[model samples]
Target: MIRGVLALIPDEFRRFTPRYLALVVLLALSQAAAYLLSVPVLQALFDGNYGDAWRWTSWLAVAVAATAVFGYLQSMVGLRIGVGMLRSVQTRLGDHLSTLPLGWFGTTGSGAISRIIVGNVREILGVFSHLLSPVLNAVLVPIVVAVGILFVDWRVSVAMLISLPLLLVVNRLANVGYSRSNQRIHDAASEANSRVVEFAQAQPVLRAFGATGAGNKALDGALRRQQKASTDAVFASVPGLMVFALCVHAVFLLLVYVVIGRATGGDLSIASAIALIAVSSRFIEPLNQAAQLSNALRSAGSAAQRINTFLAERELAEATAPVQLSEPSIVFDDVAFGYSEDEPLITGASFEVSAGTTTAIVGPSGSGKTTLLRLASRYYDVDSGSISVGGHDVRQQPSETLLGQVSLVFQDVYLFNQTIEENVRLGRPDATADEVRRAGEMARVDEIVERLPDGWATVVGEGGASLSGGERQRISIARALLKDAPIVLLDEATSALDPHSEAVVVRGIHELTRDKTVVVVAHRLSTIAHADQILFVDAGRIVERGTHDELLEQGGRYAAFWGERSRATGWHLAPSTYRSDLNGALGG
Candidate 1:
């Protein structure tokens, strides 16, 4: 686990490795000097050599001061390395995520992904910056002190060494329990984060329904579970830790007894006995520190594993030799697809849209209208058959190449938390100010922007929460216009707008789709009355297709849909009392 985390440290951080090693060596040497100084100082004092004892103490103080300087340098360097790696990894991960298919984001919830990127990465950083030095010192200082003790008296050293294996065994048992509990705690934390994000995002809807309290059940349960897991982790490991401490104390007592017995029998000098006893305390202190750090190590291990797993996720394969498109037309030939393999949402569907024509796809909810558009856009690969744009199979071209020729505007509009102008400019980052304004005017975005206090400079809140749905839709259209791609895909782009806003947006859509090969998954049948072609999708198939008037004249499924929609436009609610009186009069 430690090795896996170290591997994440990029090559740029290796420059600080030597500095850290130097700090560890200096710490161990200083510790040995401090314990070893006690022997000569005590011997000199017993012989009334006060001057010699003072000199030895002064030298030990110097070593300690030097160790402090080295420790400070190590801290600064480690911090730089840790923070640098954190930022680098985050940037790289974000870039990689952007290249992944939209399906990956949908499968991994935003809350879970955020927790991994922000929370788990921070934990891993703590492991590198704060935990590493203490861990290394704990291991290295003990070895240095143990060797120093051996030169004083091998028998006492042997007794001290005997307790190490027992302490290690107890620590191992404690770590096993700690690891299991820590994993549960980590999982619970991720779940709690997800619930918190969900609750926050749904707050407006929950309040409207007067069910905020009821809606909090999931988040509350997750928090309670996390608290219990934390408590259980402590309870599970504390007993083993206590046992380890007791074993260390027992060894300390045994060493003290052996030294005292040897001194009393005149086999050991008084100075040597006292020095060995003093050094024994130092030796065991590192062991205790190492034992306490076991839990932190376990947590870091789990976090690192998650990060590595995410980084290792597969990405969509790009063609080695990508094919270039010769036209703007789209052809779906016997295409089949599903979120899951066994449950196909689109099967054996074939269609063609010539360049510079408008084709509207109308269907009931969940009839695969959006799925078909998504496939055409290469958001997901088709399961069986080909989806070609401009005579080139989407899979035969690089995703970037295929995407560059298409502009997508969907019902759900997403805007970054940036100035309105900047959001629109995302379609073409290098677009001139004049070009942006022109596109915005064409898409009717300038009308909405002009109403804001800052006009184009106004910062939209996250996901454009500050803007109304229609306003956001206009901005999205503006972006599509600015890109000026040959093929435009619309998925009920005006479905969320009010009647007034829909009229303004429809004008913008005309400008965007003019002379462009367009495929619209339309919700409003009336809007597409003049469409060159209308494909009535049902149960994953194009059950009917013709011009708008031709389908209505055929008096089939499309005709029925048109009839129902036409009546729905004039439907109205009447007062119950008035309706009943009218009915009674008619009966009389």
Candidate 2:
């Protein structure tokens, strides 16, 4: 624990260079004043000079005032240092997280990362601020006082130094035990936080199942475990404190006894003996502070371990010499991928979409349709084989260049907590208000603005919770339209829309794709009837490929799926009759 406290000095003290040096001078001056004040007070007592004692008492007051000023400066400096270091840590952490492969997010829980970045960082700062200042004062002030003690009498100084080994042993024992407990407590707390996040995110589903209470109870259990671990750590520190207190008391007693014995023998002057006792009392204070700070240091070490673990994570591969794209032609050559090693999501999938054509992917659920689209956008790299945009391999292409050619619209749309216009402007931050309005008009979102109380400037709640699903879908399309990237990956982009809204959005998509390469994961067969090509996937393999009419003629997996969906839609019936049939099925 002492070693850790010492380690923070280089990283933390390098900042505030001038202020730190000033603080040191001020601390030394205050310690000297304290020693002198004790001398005058003791001398007055020995000679029964009450007037002289009061004069020295006034000097003590001045010393205290100076110390207070330095103390305030120390606090301000510590805060500035801690906050700056924290910001540095956060920036580096964010950059590292962005570089990490997408698969890491799914496997490594969000709660764990939150604990390391937020909770553990707080602990680290607490440890540094609470322990470091006192540790510095403890080592420095004691040496100055010890030198003064030696000038008064070498025997007194030796008496004080004898107790040092005992204090060191107590601190070491306490730190060893507390460190182990702190490590467990921190780990348990991280797990508990992660569970709470998971539970909250899953609450809607849990409520639907009437299992909300069960989830709450499970969370409570996790919290209980975390509390138990923390309590155990606090308890582990008690035994060390007991040993420390015993040593401090023994040292104080030893000093007083030796001084009285020497004075009785007439070997020590009464004035000097009195001063030595006063100085011994002052010296004990920082040693006690050192003991307390040792506990804080131990806990901080645990938190630091967690923070270092997070920082060590692999970052995303970055290109030093980035090349820009001149075209957007996504080609997948024998691509294979899986989120985990045991379950292959895409296997030997091969396809191509030229720079100005639309390709539709149709498949049953879990058939790698979305995975393929994600690969095209480089959300996750292909496990084996190559994906190239234009002539450069996607892996070698810079992120900036790839993003310039790609715009993604998916079923799950996310809008920042901002105005409608601002959300749409994310795709092209430099887009003008007129450009934004035009994109909204093309995405069929004009009606939505006309109905809204604030139109474009209205605030959207987090994730656009204030908007209806169809409205959110339209806004997502507007964003894509505004981006106007050459390659648009549409993954069930209209899944949340009603039939009319779906028609409008699909029309907007078609218009947008007119002279661009589009790869779509189409859920509704009606949306892809005119697509230039269709790939039917099953069990991570492309089973068939052709135009809609041609696939129907083939009568393979595509035909069977089309038939099932057609029966479900009951499109053959007249509009009114189909509504009646749907009502009958629902018992309306």
Candidate 3:
């Protein structure tokens, strides 16, 4: 864990590692000089040499001032290093996370990632900036003082050194127990945070069900567990910490006894004994500080391990030499993939989407329809076969190159907490105001924007909470339209819209996909009646493939789906049928 923490220190700061070490050495020297300077001052006063006492006092003041200056510099340098490393690490982690597979995000909740990125990262800052110098001083200053005492009286110094091993044993015992408790506390805190975020996000649903109180049980339970864990951690470590404190105090007592014994035996002078007592008092301070810092180091070690694990997560390997796409078409040749190795979401999936054509995929909820679109977009790599876009394998092309070729509009739309215009502009960051306005007009998002009090400048709130589902969908469509990639993937893009809004969005999609390769996954059978090709997917395979009308004529899976959808589309509640059912139920 200490190694992991050290690894997080950026190389830029590491270049000054020698300077930091030198500072620590200087700090220890300054501390020892201040302590040692007291020796001559005490001896002159005891000898009644007023002139020599004044001279020693002057030197002692200078040593004290120098120590203060060095301490200040150490703090300034540590702060600068800590803040700089924090910024660099956060930025690097954010960039690296973007390159990881989307499946990783799904499996690891946002709450867990945010806790590491925001909370644990700050813990690292404490480890590097605030903790490092003090820990170094604690170790180095004591050794320097011990060496000085050795010259004063070797036997007394030997006794002091013996206490060093005792300090180590107690600290080790305390740290081992504290580390286990600290880990439990950290896990409990993370779980509590995750539950709070989940509850907050689901508040509207809970209220609608009139079960908000009941729904809070999980979050409340998590909080209780966190409280209990925290208490347990403190209690579990207190005994060992008490023992450690007792050991440290005992060492101080031993040092005092040794100093008195040496002075009485005539081996040490009165002034020398007095100086040793003063130095001994200062010496045990560093040992106590070392014991206190042990707990912080253990917590930091745990935090560092988590951060290292996140940093070590695997990313999709980019091609060393990327291949260029020859066309806008997409092809899947015996593609197979799964979130886990044992459960495949897609298998033996083979299909070809020709350039400037529309292909629609339809299936049941867990039939891998959306997964197919995700695979085509390279959100996840295939396990068994290759997925090629524009005659080049997607894995053979760079992510940037592949992403530039396709625009995806998923069923679930997320908008940043920014202006409607800025959200749309994300589709093409360099796009001009006029281009944004044009895309909005095409997607009919302009209608919604105009209704807002701030128009295009309005804040959308987190995830566009202020807007209706269909409004958010139109904005998403506008974004995709502005991107204008040659290949478009749509997953229930119009599912949230009313008939009129759906018609407008459909028109926008049609305009955007004109002369482009399009792959769509839709549950509404009516929406894809005019698709150039329709694939009926079931249980990770395309069970049927043909044009919509052709599939309907075959009377297979697609035909059955169509029949159910058509009946549902025309059916409505009848008063006479409802009355008959009510009477039957009542036996009237």
TM-score of each: 0.91, 0.84, 0.95
- Full-model lDDT, candidate 2: 0.78
Residue 400: error of model 1 in Å? 3.1
Better of 1 and 2 by lDDT: 1
lDDT of 1 at 255: 77
Tell me the spans in candidate 1 whose CA falls farther than 4 Å from its real position: 51-55, 213-215, 319-323, 549-556, 575-588
- Give candidate 2's TM-score: 0.84
Best-performing candidate as measured by lDDT: 3
Compared with the true structure, what per-residue lDDT tens digits does model 1 show for residues 1-588?
Answer: 887677678788877777767876786678667766677777777777899989987987887787787778778877887898799778877877876777787778776788788987888887757787777776677667666667778887677666666677777886787788877887788788898877776777778877576457788898899899999999988887887888878878887899899999998888777777777787788788887887787688788888888888777667768675798999999998888778898988898999988899998889999989888988888889999998899888877788889999988889999999999999989999999999999988889887889999999988888888888988999999999999999986675678988988888888998899999987776656878899999989899999998998999998888888889878777788778989999994
**What lDDT does candidate 2 reach at residue 530?**
77
lDDT of 2 at 463: 80
RMSD of each: 3.5, 4.5, 2.3
lDDT ranking, high to low:
3, 1, 2
Prediction 1 global C-alpha lDDT: 0.83
Ranking 1 against 2 by TM-score, winner: 1
